[model samples]
Target chain A: QKEVEQDPGPLSVPEGAIVSLNCTYSNSAFQYFMWYRQYSRKGPELLMYTYSSGNKEDGRFTAQVDKSSKYISLFIRDSQPSDSATYLCAMIRDNYGQNFVFGPGTRLSVLP
Target chain B: DARVTQTPRHKVTEMGQEVTMRCQPILGHNTVFWYRQTMMQGLELLAYFRNRAPLDDSGMPKDRFSAEMPDATLATLKIQPSEPRDSAVYFCASGLTRQGRNEKLFFGSGTQLSVL
Candidate 1:
């Protein structure tokens, strides 16, 4: 099994709809979870970051981590067209300088 | 706003030619990472450096690829005799590893490479 896995979604949704993006990992050692957003022809930018097995909220985005299930999720509330992009989930072990394991990003399009 | 900078936003080279991608990491950030992104493989970590020393490069092909940090500000990835499969967007990211913990990463616009 891949270390990290995500549905490569070209998930389409109307503006203002709630979108939930999820990832599952095979490694139980992953401690830090992050979500990155990439626009067309642009580099990815950090969208949300969380360490613990709970939810972290920032404005319209919420990041949730569940260590027991080895699953993580990012929820976008009242999404906008500007939110249309590829969302990548990344995780890393607690070891110092450990490389991050990234999931195959899910492409999202919030249509108007 | 401080951000990582990469040169040659686009590169096209014939097979067997050498290609070098450069990155100027954010000043004061001690950690630098090089990643290659493709539709089939997603984002793959190629190499990384900490305090100008290579920390890990297991993901890279040692025979044809080499990464180095000449100074605190500059890092380079070179592919000698590039192949068509080497075509991918390469991104440089910098982060401050505080207390041995990897912090948030700031990525550059990336070098879109096409090896024909």
Candidate 2:
């Protein structure tokens, strides 16, 4: 199985709606979880970052991690058209930023 | 406004040619990473360096791929005898790696490569 796996979703949603993107991993060693957003033809940019299992909120975005289940999720509240992008989940095995792995990414589109 | 910069925003070369991609990391960032993004594979880490020394490159195909940090500010990834499968967007990311903290990576716009 892949180290990290996410549904490559072209999930369409209306503006102001809440969107949830998720990723599951087979490796329990992953300690740091991150969410990156990428626009078309652009590089992925860090959106949210969390360590271990809990929640980290940054403005309208929240990242959740469940180490027990090896799952991570990113939730966008009050989504906007500008929020349309591909969301990739990344994880690191340790504190040194080594053994980094990324998921397949889910493509999201928030329409007006 | 400081961001990682990548050169030759787009490159088109024939198969068997040598393709070199360059990156100018943000100043004061001690860690550099090279990644490739494709539709089939979302984003793959090719290699990474810490303090100008290569730490890991196992993700790269050593037969035709090589990465190096010649100086503090510059990093390069070269693919010799490039093949069609080598056509993918190459990205360079830079960050400050703390001893006990997670690093926040800043990625460049990426170099779109097309090997014909």
Clashing pairs in 1: none
What would the per-residue lDDT of candidate 2 be over residues A11-100, giving only the tens digit for each residue?
999999999999999988788888999999888899987887889999999999999998899999999999999999988888565846
DockQ of 2: 0.67
Per-residue lDDT of model 2, residues B13-101, tens digit only? 99999999999999999999999999988789899998998989999999999999999999999999899999999999998888944
Clash-forming residue pairs, model 2: none
Interface RMSD of 1: 0.6
Write model 1 residue lDDT over A41-103, tens digit each, in one string: 999999998998999999999999999999999999999999999999998889898988899
Q: How would the docking of model 2 be graded?
A: medium
Displacement of the residue B49 alpha carbon in candidate 2, Å: 0.7
* Model 2 CA lDDT for position A40: 92
- lDDT for A4 in candidate 1 is 96
* Ten contiguous residues with the weakest lDDT in model 2 chain B: B97-106
lDDT of 1 by residue, B1-116 (tens): 99999999999999999999999999999999999999999999999999999999999999999999998989999999899999999999999998898989889999999999
True contacts kept of 1: 0.84
